[model samples]
Target: MIAKGTPFVASYSGGKDSTLALWRAVRAGGKPLALLTMLDETGGRSRSHGILPAVLDAQAAALGLPRISGQASWGDYERVFVEQLGRARAMGAVAAVFGDIDLAAHRQWEEQVCAQASLAPVLPLWGEDRLALVREFVDAGFAARIVVIRRDLMADDYLGRVLDHALIERMLADGIDPCGEAGEFHTLVTGGPLFAKPLALADGDVRADGDYLSLDFGLAASI
Candidate 1:
């Protein structure tokens, strides 16, 4: 566990895992230096969840934290990620938080990149029961919606569904990991104890790309 009040950077993806990770870090008394997200070379969409920059900014605003993003291609992803880690370090971040659960390859990569950047890699959700983590996230008042799903593993009906106990049970009944750890799904967190305000999402058409379906959501007009 990170020392209380230690400055940390969150490896944010504007998704459920990152949201839960950040929330736990704050609750554990870490000072959040920034939310760092990786973007595609065009800086149009997040590499993982296809979330737009504007929506990410809105999330940062609600969290009262700065959003730091870098554009990178597949070939230079690690280099760009290390650079972001260095930037966060320069901002007084002593460690960086990750949300990977039981993925040895992911953990190895994070540790390697953090070592290169001289930042300690912290994984709060590592090695825990997936179902328990999902339950904790929802039960703790974090509100999230399914924003991406594997077409081969999930149906269109799951797109944009709010994450809750019932939803997790349904996914489990379908023989999927409740936490979506195996690339079965991705999510967009809209509200929770960590946010100062809830995001009003303007739903967009669902689009399919190869084996994945993505939800195109934008910030709705605030009344």
Candidate 2:
């Protein structure tokens, strides 16, 4: 468990795993100082999920946390992330929390970067059973929707669908990972126990990038 009452920076991706990690951290009495996100080179969308800045802001607002985002290309991602972590450290953050479940290389990088920034690395979901983790998130009342999927692995119809038992069963029947850990899919969480209110989203255009088909999502003006 994280040291209670200690301020920590969350490696937020606006996805189910990160959301669950944040939720767990809060429940364990960790104080979230900021939500750190990596943006594309233009700083318009997230690096992995393609969520807009406004959309991420809404998510941060819902969770009542500050959003700290940085823009960088693939070549400079590590440097940019470490720079942000340094800023967070200066802001009194002693640890960095991540949502990675079982990626050894990813965890190593997270630890290395945190060490460089003078912060300890914390991974709440490390080594947990993937399928059980999905059930835990859903049962804990966290709501999320699919936002991207591998075109070769799933149909476009899978996009924008809620992550729930039915979807889990379907994915299982289709022989796909429930958590989509193998790059099978990605999701955007809209509501959950950690949120003060739900985010309003609208479906935008669908575009194909590499092996993935992404469903662009826009935030509603009400936010």
Candidate 3:
């Protein structure tokens, strides 16, 4: 458990859930110690969403928080991820936050990783109704844009689109998980309650690769 004023880092993927998790931590009075991300070795992008590292840094700046990131090859994901958390722990972080909802495997992985670093794993939105949670996140004023989509599950049209109630409804109507828990989609948050200032972003073109669609975008904020 994290006592008040103890440092807590959020394992941010620039995704909606992780954004919400960070917001919850702030709401609970925890310091926004740092944003931890795993950058892909192919390029300095987030492994989960292919978002540029510079863009993520801009987002972090908008939130008035520092970032800790490291590059990792495809084969080194798990090891590198835990290593980043270990670094945060060594820096005096006592708790780590994750945005997982109800996936047992994910929860187990989070628990194991945090345990290895002697940091408590905090899941503020765990086990909640998916639809409700989606609604709640938007209602709470978080702004997120779809940054990646699994081509087989989602059309390229969704790339770079803002995640809103209408989008959620459309996803549900298409038999897709509104929250994209089944790998249907991934998001990048640009604005929210936790942010000291909203991120300024401009959407770019979308590219389709072998099973994934990547949305190109740029984030900028005054430092």
Candidate 4:
């Protein structure tokens, strides 16, 4: 149970896949101890989807968990991530959870890193149907919005669009992976069963990030 990892620290990306993975892990008796994210060397944005630190903080607050993060360049992403895993392990995490569905390379890398940190690797969504995984997240009451898209693989118009049934179906019809596992798109989860409350997000301008286009967002003004 729990893929042999309890009291795990989820490798969170502030995205739906990771959120769903965390949910399923808890359902399977995993003890979620903390969230871990990798930030760019600049220390301003998350490397996975360009998510801001504030967004991640809001997510952690909503989930009632602490976060462990490290800033690193692509050249040292693995080292930094391993160090972060070490930090989580030192905090009593026996394993690290991931959201990889069907990507062999991704899983391999995750496993390697967990091994380096002496932590078990948990993959709750591993081998699940891609389309069904997306549906599961939506049907389970989780809400997310597209926050980044690869310019070569997807249209920029998808930025800021919520991951609803319609959008998923359209992506499938267009030959895009609904799960976006191959990096076609990335999302920021706003609300879900795992959260104490939904996050309020205010849209901002889209900025180009090399081969990807990222949308900026912030916590909405509290009324």
Cα lDDT for residue 24, candidate 2: 89
Per-residue lDDT tens digits of candidate 1, residues 17-101?
A: 8888888888899999999999999999998889988899999999999999899999999999999999999999999999998
Which runs in model 1 stand beyond 4 Å of their true positions? none
Q: Clashing residue pairs in candidate 3, if any?
A: none
Model 4 score (lDDT) = 0.91
- State the displacement of the C-alpha of residue 143, model 4, in Å, after optimal TM-score superposition: 0.3
Q: Candidate 4 lDDT, tens digit per residue, 116-199?
A: 999999898999898898999999999999999999998878889999999998898888998997889999999989899999
Error of 4 at 50 (Å): 0.1
Per-model TM values vs. the true structure: 0.98, 0.97, 0.93, 0.95
Poorest stretch of ten by lDDT in candidate 4: 1-10
The lDDT per prediction is: 0.92, 0.92, 0.85, 0.91
Q: 51-156 in candidate 3: lDDT tens per residue?
A: 8877898888888888998788878877888888888888888899999999999999899988988889999889999999889999999998898899899877
In order, how many clashes per candidate? 0, 0, 0, 0
lDDT for residue 95 in candidate 2, whole number 0-100? 95
Query: How many pairs of residues in model 3 come into backbone collision?
Result: 0
